[model samples]
Target: MGKALIAGVMRWQNTLDLTMSPGNVVAKPLEHVIAANDANKFIAYNNIPPDIPKIKTKSNSKANKNKC
Candidate 1:
C-alpha cells in the first residue's frame, strides 16, 4: 500500500517535472490512486464517523491514580 503511494507520487513528479515535495504530490494523486484501486468503496462500506474519540485518561491521570 505504502509503496504504491510512493510510486504514484514519483510518477506524478516525473510527468510534471516537479521537485519531491509532499504538499505538491501527496494528497491529490494519492486520492486518485485510492479511488482507482476501489478503496473508497470499502471505506464507504465501513461508514466511520468523522469524529475523534476522546481519550478518557492521559499519562498524568494514570500517575495520579497510582498515588504513591
Candidate 2:
C-alpha cells in the first residue's frame, strides 16, 4: 500500500509538472500570418498609392458587362 501511494503521488506530480511547464503552450503559425496582414492593412490605410487608378462603377453597366 505504501508503494502504491508513492506511485500515485509521483503520477500526480508528473501531471502537475506537465500542466505548469512554460513550453507546453505553443502559438499557431497562422497567428504570425494574421499579425502580418494587420500590419499591412495599417500601412496601406496610412499611405495610399498614387499610381493606382481609381475605379468608378456605373449603376447601369451591370447588365452588359461580361468581363469582371
Q: What is the C-alpha lDDT profile of model 2 across 11-33, one tens digit per residue?
A: 42212332233454332423443
Clash counts per candidate, in order, are: 0, 0
Winning candidate number (TM-score): 1
Query: What tens-digit string does per-residue lDDT give for candidate 1 at 1-68?
Result: 13232464554222332234446655555555345463453333223333435454463244545558
> In model 2, where is the ten-residue run with the lowest total lDDT?
12-21
C-alpha RMSD for every candidate: 11.0, 18.1
Per-model lDDT: 0.42, 0.38
Off by over 4 Å in 1: 1-23, 32-63
**TM-score (all chains, Cα) for each model:** 0.17, 0.15
